[model samples]
Target chain A: MTTEIVIFAVLFLIVSGMGFVASRWRRPDDIASLNEWGLGGRNFGSWITWFLVGGDLYTAYTFVAVPALLFGAGATGFFAVPYTVIVYPLVMIVLIRLWSVSHVHGLVTPADFVRARFGSPTLALLVAITGIVATMPYIALQLVGIEAVLKTMGVTGDLPLIIAFAILAAYTYQSGLRAPALIAFVKDALIYVVILVAVIYIPTQLGGWGSIFDAAQAKFDKTPAATDGILLNANNQLQYVTLALGSALALFLYPHSVTGVLASKNRDVIKRNMSALPAYSVLLGLIALLGYMAIAAGVTPIGTDVNTVVPQLFDKMFPDWFAGVAFAAVGIGALVPAAIMSIAAANLFTRNIYREYINRDATDAQQASASKIASLVVKVGAVLFILLIDPQFSIDLQLIGGVIILQTLPSVALGLFTRWFHRAGLIAGWIAGMGAGMLMLYNVANPATHHDHFGGSAFALSKLGLDTKMTIYAGFLALAVNLIVALLGTVIAKSAKVVDGPDATRTDDYTADQGDPRVHDLEVTSST
Target chain B: MTTPRTDRSPWNWLLLLPIAIPLIPALFNAVEPRLFGIPLFYWLQLGFVLVSVAATLVVYHMTRRAR
Candidate 1:
């Protein structure tokens, strides 16, 4: 009805058409293999990988929820910058090794790497389950991004949301990872245009950067809490640091991110992308400032949804036509990652659970078919997560999702470096970390959002009997407990003469490149 | 272009610098000494992105063998 909505719908439909046709983009000889369907044939060079990975990592969540975070709570929202900036170099150090070894062993997922490196199917199962459950809320949250834009545009109801997922499901089921891979080009181009315009054009109209900061500072300073200022206070700085660090640690551990990485052509492609990926972090910084601009523009969210602040600001600040482009940037933005996530989750299920446990002798075509169906089921499940459950509760669960995924750090991240810990020790440590993380997450309450339990990630130190209001990230604390338990379990297992499990990886496998003789060939379908 | 594992350069350690730099709050948390009227807290963090991209680039090039 409105110009913005019309433009958004037109652009969205055109892109969905492109996604449908994307099955032919790189056309493998046999498109039904798990390698082709799930990973886009592992042939993306630097440029395509750049766009795909960028689109997948910086989601609709970054555009909608992040600025809303800044709109609601001031300085802590900027933690997104450090979280993304630090993640690349940290992951680059370990991820090339992951890329190399996965290629060498035909590993399709991180859990595949775990199964090979840890030699324990139980640990691998735990890692797989963690990746899947954490990603479900995340996929659902992407819809929230679209929902906010739609709600702001006067479009409401479950039908539109269901329609959006149906389109996403159709293209993804038709083309697999290639669908999102092709669609990401459009998503990133639109986002870059929208971000460049908003960051540059809007500031001049709303006085300037100084006034924006001043407004945000004034609003936060008027609040009684010490934690809401534009500058970090001592009380909440601990939360900021730990939350950022913990999030950065969890970023790549998610199955979908590894899907992006493992889909690249070779080690060099990954190496190049890591350094270049910070470009998105820089874009994220500019996007985060949109919150302050919203404050200066006097944009209030519709009712209680703080996530609508950025979209509402766009509607008010931009002409209706341009606002539509901004909305499309975010709406299309959700598709790239959500599609990839369901595909990744499906791959994990089909590879680790469905194949490893269900039918060990399942053929490649069967695995691909199963993954395609599982991807559809995952999408429907994500939609139900938003539709049946309270959407705000979905957001809270997404926060808890971060803490859930962090429990895999010891096995996924550290296991990339060493296999010294006995398999059972790693398993025990995971259980303790997961249990503690969940318990801590359950106790976190946010008076602002009015949730009594399972509210957020920041846990107060006083809860553990410390004399302070200072709180740290629950994921950070849970990870510390995990490492300690893992170390203790390792010592106990070692003294008890419990032998470490077999490691299928060789020392040289860590450094293998694309051309290395051991790197699994794309044409090889036989099991080792 | 693939360097052998035994011949890997020590320059790989430079990767840690960029990762560690952003974690230290005292380094970039200041509000004053602004850039383009933007606070140091904001612009300086964006500056760290450039710093990181540069560090990663250098390590990538230095370790990469000439074909």
Candidate 2:
């Protein structure tokens, strides 16, 4: 435990040192501008942006959760593998257009695009607030990942976590996007080393591949659980497929994801990233197998928490010193994504709400300062959420975030493809999607367990006399409803002679690449 | 003026080659033995690092050409 603490402490200092130095990496004379502070000067090349966004997307939760889920639920955990596989193709289709449109309109947040598209500040505010609300618990889940590692290392007390988050907030507040941008290189390097070492060395430590599988199958068969140790089953098939498709659609709609896309130098970079980023998925498949290995190794479930499985597996398999290094790897993994998510959420608040509503004529520096302060506030809020609320409950809430953010798809993702839906129709679609999504999510109960306050599933189609025995992720179903309502509303508005706003932006502008003089950075003011 | 005489082909569908390269081994592992003297799982995973680096380089070159 002391070794783990020492390694983590050293890692925290190193990460903070990187953050302080990152302010000068791009060497902007004034860090007050939103372009410099929030978006890292919008000058990231293919390699840096590739690592930054890749590191941002594939996170500690992934390192911990994918394996944990596989360990707990068997083959269903591999949903992460396929979901990631399809994400790039899905991103390739949508994000290039989003980048072009955002670049052309000087839009910093999706809500800014919504405001300009619909000429309704109210609708934009709704989108912005939805983004921030959805992003908050997601950030808290990163802390949950950190907490899982800490607990597995037998490190007690809240002081260490509080100190860790304080350091994270300080650097994030000081360095902004550049902090994550610089740290991503080191984070990816460490993760690759740890995972690689584990995949090879751990199997060798436990007998061999055949022994691991044989032991796992034997344990599952004798454990009195109905299902055996195999990957597929009649019960979980629906959940697996729907969860994957739903999560893939939800991934790029995240404000942080779009923020990453917008920071790129051109359209081709977006396309290249979309195609190339799935390289991590190949790594993800191997990571998922660690779950099965832990089961085979006679490692009893420690802490009764799924997230702690990987850390415990490490603690049992490796030396204390190496286990400390692995703990630091997972811990640092959480920080990179958590920092990016908070900044992205804060940008939505500053650009869409604080600037759009609170102070319309605010300078660029003011926007940057507001975003910085808001980011710290957001991180602190996430810390309070994880500490005060049940960590398991917060993780379940992040699944709900998956549902809520997916509701934005028709507006953000589909909007990138076409503008035929009227602003009124889009707003109506959003309200209905959100309303239906929340109601269904509220009613979802884990049938396996007895505690019934707001189970993660929205509506059990089974109760409606539907023949299907599968549970659908409520957000995916809500978006289907959103699309139908949006189309009908579009037709109604077209026939009713509603006043349409002037189309200041055209579809072709989205297809436009870099070197267009119209796309330029906006300067900002420091709020403090 | 930008040169616009010939070669208006869409920017190398082969630029998408990196995405598919990983899947090839994923397909191979579906039915094979002794990849690098380890089972399909370990070899395929360690192989991804090398594959990712190679693909990243390929992508970097392709993207650089477009610039």
Candidate 2, which segments miss by more than 4 Å at Cα? A157-164, A222-229, A380-397, A446-450, A454-459, A517-528, B1-67
Best by TM-score: 1
Q: Determine which window of 10 residues in candidate 1 chain A has minimal summed lDDT.
A: A388-397
Q: What would the TM-scores of all predictions be?
A: 0.95, 0.86
Residue A448's lDDT in candidate 2: 38
lDDT of 1 by residue, B1-67 (tens): 3546632568878877777888888888888998877888999988889878998888777766456
Give each model's whole-structure lDDT. Answer: 0.82, 0.70
Candidate 1 lDDT tens digits, A1-528: 389989999999999889778888866877788878887877776677677778765686788877887888887888888888888888778777888888898886789889899788888999998898888778887877887888899876665577667777888899888888888888888998999999999999989899999889888888887777787778888988888888888878989888778767776667778878887788899999999999999999877778789899999999999999999999999878889889989988887898888988888899899999998888777777665444333334455668889889999889888887788788888899988997887788767667666667778999999999998989899989988899899989989988677899988888887767788753253221
Writing each residue's lDDT as its tens digit, candidate 2 over A1-528 gives: 677668866886787799889999968877887767877876777687787778755576577777776676565566666566656655655676777777777777788777777677767787888888778767877877787787786766775477557766888888888898899988888888889999889888888766765565566677665433443455555565677678777778889988877777776666667656766776777777788888977665544567777888888888777888888888888888888999899988887788767888888788888888888878877776565444233335466678788777877777776778887787788888888887777667654344453555435578558896656667778888888888888889889978765556776666656666665542222222
DockQ of candidates 1 onward, in order?
A: 0.65, 0.12
lDDT for residue A262 in candidate 2, whole number 0-100: 75
Give candidate 1 regions above 4 Å deviation. A157-160, A384-398, A522-528, B1-4
